[model samples]
Target chain A: MADQPTPFERFIQGILPENPVYRQLLGLCSTLAVTNGLKPALTMAGAVMFVLFSANVIISLIRNLLKPHLRIVVFTLTIAAFVTIVDRFLAAYMYQMSKALGPYIPLIIVNCIIICRCEVCASRQSVLTAAADAVGQSIGFGLALCSIAVVREILGTGMLAGFRVLPASWPSWTIMVLPPGAFLTFGLLLGLVNWIDAVRSRKKL
Target chain B: MEQQQPDRRMRLRSGFKNSNLAQAWLVLLLALVFGSALAAVQVNLGHVIEANKVNETLEKIPELVFGADAARKLKQRQVPIEITPGTIAVEKDGRKAYYKLFRVTRDGTPAGWVIKARGQGYADVIELLIGLDDRAQTITGIFVLEQKETPGLGNNIGTARWRSQFVAKSTDRPLVVVKGGAKRPDAIDAVTGATISSRSVTRIVNRTIEDLRGRLIPAKIEFSERHG
Candidate 1:
């Protein structure tokens, strides 16, 4: 068995070493689909955070009772329950944002990030440890989404959260608002992160 | 391989088939508990979720049916009425179609009607709210409620510039979509790259206006004759 990570280390791990979107590459569908605009990207991240935190806490509480054969089914039910709550709440309160996100909200049930955490951390760890991991991974996912959105929104519409950030005379890159822009931006950012990691390793040597 | 009898009675035994029965029962228990939890949440929040949906569509009715000036004036006196197609007109398939219309009154006199319309577009269904003048002779305005046209091209159907062109457009003849320089009074300019989407909206609006006019003109005539 691996040594129990310190709470601080557990939290930081999601943001750096095992970032859900950037490092682990889980939940890429939402990462690519909603990151065209900042508001939607953040709102999606918020929903994921809620689901992850609640599912982790619940699974950790029931860890002992989980049967080997029924484990996958139980984990799915727990994650799905949290997802339904988030989905209903968003539709009722923030109707416009809910509409903007559309099918992506329901797609959270299959995000893989929440289920992976339940299997890897919550199934064996204390509730507090599981909660810490959920928070850390969610932050990591949020950072990755926001970074992509910042680049896409700024270049696509020359605006940030609906406010004009660039001069009117500056021509907006129309491609940046389309699917191709999402692919290009994510590719470059992934390459940049990899390069940074390589430089850091060389420095350590 | 070990030979095992395939008997239902044996399978139900706890350890008869290597604990498969126990695993099945455990899964069933978990399923029941979680399913009920989801059902409970749904029941508690069903009303609020439904109301939000109605409001999302209701809020757009006035803006689409009345011109900006009259719509604002009539906003304070908006009355939503649900109508069945059979009540309004004879139908081929009474079960297939239903219409939601809004009655706008000013100073206790009926001012306008906003009717919802839907039809297939280039990529998906195009839903719209179309306004008719009280006389039911001309279209007052139009609003695209929902569409799934190709983004950056067909999606331009929802732009303010495109929608604004429908204001005060005569419904005397069926609406037509034109390429450029829509010189004809009944012709509308199609979006540069979205001819099919623009045509779809025009076709839907025209068909809806024809269907509604058949039911409404007689109703208006009878209403005025009795009230005047």
Candidate 2:
């Protein structure tokens, strides 16, 4: 299509227009599941970013050798391999965090963000471009997760990263820590992003 | 010779209508190669994974048996475990669930017992470690090992505030879960939205204590006394 965007533009695009979570809606399962607290949300984001970066670099380097008929198969195999490495590494090094994450780490195998990046960008672009996109999209996805976690943790427990934020006099909202809270906060944040975009486009016109 | 037909060369073509055997073989080969690579990694990391798992359990033992502050006291002491030959059976919903009990000693003296317990919770089997005092008369602490309960509701059983209720609870009678509020020592307040899970945990802890007390504790006490 058009000439590839500069790396800076690509990074910006990932955070706004083509965000894997909020804009593209690629990896909603994890986006919703792990954002209840700061630690889990951050860990999930790191795992996704690592998988995406590695998979993109490798896939782009070998894109020419990939046969059209076997492209999806190769992509999945590569993604699964990277995911396992991350899972084992976490279990060994960050034992408690690995335990806290539980099944979510292994579930990264099926995260659509990494697979989507491989198909859309990595397969068609240079290694450098693919790597840039991976980093950008990962930050976008991580930001979305962190935003939700910040709200939930503060409102639900009156704490942020285990430190008290709200005054003790303020009544904590217990529902904010539950499953429904995830949906409510995410929905509101998505709407806010859309609203801001609408205002920016109108000003441009 | 004129009547004999010339042999025509067959071109291998892969298209939409025709199946591509070469491509199929390539896909299979890719899968096989990658699968072997994954297997190799797993085999190499197998020991590390096993050791981490055992360490995870060992690391939680002291904290589960003692409060956070007191758990550090166990650092210098080697916590020896003595496993019992038989398992304890507890009935819930017409099914018999079995639990294993282990005696935990601090420096060759009996200090406590950590029972590996399980019960049918709301959605899945809840596994936990129940730590009891030396006499097996009071529960020192409880730690949930594994659970597949409802995320926001039943899963709250794993939180510290919920588990702390079991600390120093006497095991003379079966513990009960109270929905409104726990008014007595033998009763625990059920999690706000997860009555079934809270009840299940209490029942499992109570059953383990009942089954292990008579057979294991008295014999161990006599052995420790004679050794002293």
Candidate 3:
């Protein structure tokens, strides 16, 4: 444990051992809300990555000096700082996208993935480890988001990324874009992930 | 008991000095830096963001009205007026544009006054925007902006075939949507499946005119005198 970890170990740890969305299920709220469409899901993923990476590095650099009781508050303020920057940038450059995202962008501040990484990975580890951990979690989050969006877009609108994938004669299901669709799709996906993990664990045993 | 108490106090003080105080200072310092940075970015981008919003609105208005030139002409003289919670009247260049409350300006200015109208449609809430002749309050044109009726049926309020009904209608009498073609001088044909939408638009237009009569008449008189 004292020896510094290799780059491969850092990368593999994020995707497998500490997978933020799937294995840990840390940041499910935004994963569900913004994954209704491909474009929004991608944008959200990108924003989360930026905040996670930046906050993790900053937190790691100062971890030793941080008091234990106030650590959570410190992590929140750091994450919030990054989220605000992302939100303001989106509003200025991509006004329509920002409007469509609405409150979810600001809500990124409370995302457990960012806080969790700051606490578990950054608070005790080196800056490099923190950065790698943030990147890994971000990738896991992105994969989960896109996976949900792909299902919703295909079934709801008969389109993929706004382009029609189904035949012209196909009848589009309006229900897919509605609230019920989100809950159903997410639940099924969650179940599927759990089943896969269970099967994998059985094979290993 | 006395010995135990001293030991406990020593542990507590050590914990406080080593971890709690350091954590507090670190968090405080980070917060100060982040807050100031965020404030600086917001101040820098605030004007650009506002300008983008206005530009987006300006772009959408013309398309919604089906004529970019007409929308621009209207913008030149448009004065903002609020009618209800989510509705605004834009008076521009001798014409009026009425839009829903969602489009209202922050300062309570009408986006542009075209015309203000409401009527019973297929389901509920049929609002219309009719461009007016700034001087005569005569209907230059009209566009239906919103309706809650069935789609592919009642949503044709924005279609050309039904909207052509208002082309030469007098602003004098209230317009009506009839079963077939309008036999009267100011009637428009009701859509076959969308009778509700058609009727709603007609009602909205007529109701708007009724509502605007007092304001329109005085505004016209004032404009004519100023120009003349």
- Candidate 3 lDDT by residue in tens digits, A1-205: 4875654566676775767777788788888787768888999999999999999999999887777777888888888899999999999999878977888999999999899888877888888888888888788888888888889877876888779899977665655655567778888988998899899999999
Candidate 1: where are CA atoms >4 Å away? A169-172, B1-29, B73-87, B90-100, B179-184, B217-228
Docking model 3 quality class? acceptable
Candidate 2, DockQ to 2 decimals? 0.47
State the lDDT at B25 in candidate 3.
70
lDDT winner, 2 or 3: 2
Would you estimate the TM-scores of all the predictions?
0.85, 0.83, 0.69
User: Across residues B31-87, which tens digit of lDDT does each residue of candidate 2 receive?
Assistant: 787788778878888778888876656666667666666777655464443422234
For model 2, the superposed segments whose C-alpha errors exceed 4 Å read B1-33, B63-68, B76-97, B149-154, B179-183, B217-228
The best-first sequence of candidates by DockQ reads 1, 2, 3
A57 in model 1: Cα distance from truth in Å?
A: 0.9
Cα deviation of A108, candidate 3, in Å: 0.8
Model 1 chain A weakest lDDT span, ten residues long: A1-10
What stretches of model 3 exceed 4 Å from their correct place?
A: A1-7, A201-205, B1-23, B64-210, B213-228
Per-residue C-alpha lDDT of model 3 across residues B24-139, encoded as one tens digit per residue: 67667777888899889989999989888655534444333334454466557573322222344557567876544222231353333354456667777776666544332455
User: How accurate locally is residue A190 in candidate 2, as Cα lDDT from 0 to 100?
Assistant: 90
